[model samples]
Target: MMQRRTLAAGVAAFSALWLAAPLATAAVETPDALVKRLSADILETIKADPELRNGNIARISQVVDNTVMPHVNFRRMTSAAVGPQWRQATPAQRERLQQEFKLMLIRTYAGALKQVSDQRVVVKPLRAAPEDKDVLVRTEVHGKGEPVQLDFRLENTDGKGWKIYNLNVLGVWMVETYRTQFAQELNKGGIDGLINALASRTIAADAKTAKSAQP
Candidate 1:
């Protein structure tokens, strides 16, 4: 369970690096090229920024909100994580789920990305065809340890270009992992119960992150 949580944290952090791209280059760049460009760009920016490196949770959340949230199809991610219960969730419940999930990811991102050191992300050659709507972009984080495999599952929309909806971090699919957990919550407590549970976790996580970020 601890190991699973660790891998999920990797998903959260790398999801930020890959999704928090430099605005919308979606129209001009192909998905692989987009990943390549954004991965290097975000990492370099983090390496250069002192506050980001030091895990200022507020600053990290702000950066992620400004750069990461816009690019990701997080509504779809939340839907998938919620499984079939998503369709049954009322508008308010869905909205709450989205907000809590995003907050949890931002807090998770603070801890995960802070582990970045002298690492550089190298995107492997992409194999998908030009017109492919759904594709995977594979990459490896090369640094002190062995190269960690991180793959992105993305969808290309008409005007939205490419949006990441799922992440494969070290062989674990983030959405599926969360789906299993969320299903447990839904079974035990239903929609409101799930939302409340997510809210509680995110609040606790944020408080812990905030306490650790102190001087």
Candidate 2:
């Protein structure tokens, strides 16, 4: 049962990777195009680097920093996910939470990337108005098993071009999941409490990684 659960987690992680692949191919012509282009670049690096295939946490972080962070709208996502608490937080607190949340996601997703193997993603055709500020790029992840839908929500920015704010895996929105969790945390301990919790979680995860690496 334990092994089965682990395998299930692995599959879920790979599904995310499968979903992210098409974002690389997104052309600058459209938001969807830019998403595809970015996703493709990240996945291409994963495919090219045999060391990254082993799923090292550090390697995954490097990939995210280099290819993914540049195109993500962390501030917008943090504010939206935290909802009203975002306004309550001091500028410093909000910045801290945003930074921690971003790192948490990168670390979490990086861990998942290790599980992806023998899977490929297919980007569905998208049509949206050029004037539209927000658009969803729909794609599918295919493996030896059934295909699952992955949707990426992107917003156009004057300074940064297209930036991703949300991702849907199998019809589940990642931002919504975080929102619910953050609300619960805030209710239990307030905004500072929630920030501390996220910071602690990151520390614990990093410690675990370090311990595992010790000879």
lDDT of each: 0.76, 0.68
Which pairs clash in the backbone of model 1?
none
RMSD in order of candidates: 3.1, 4.1
- Encode model 2's per-residue lDDT on 64-139: one tens digit a residue: 5665565678788899889898988899998899888977776565555555555555778876776788888887
TM-score per prediction, in order, is 0.88, 0.80
User: How do the residues 1-215 of candidate 1 rate in per-residue lDDT, one tens digit apiece?
Assistant: 65544454454348447435475442557778777777777777777777876767678777777777655789999999999989999999999999888877766666566565566678888898877888999988666545677888988777457778998888889899999989889999999999998889988986786777579
- At residue 112, what lDDT does model 1 achieve? 63
| Worst ten in a row by lDDT for model 2 | 18-27
lDDT of 1 at 130: 79
Off by over 4 Å in 1: 1-19, 23-26, 210-215
* Total backbone clashes of candidate 1, pairs 3 or more residues apart or in separate chains: 0
lDDT of 1 at 34: 74
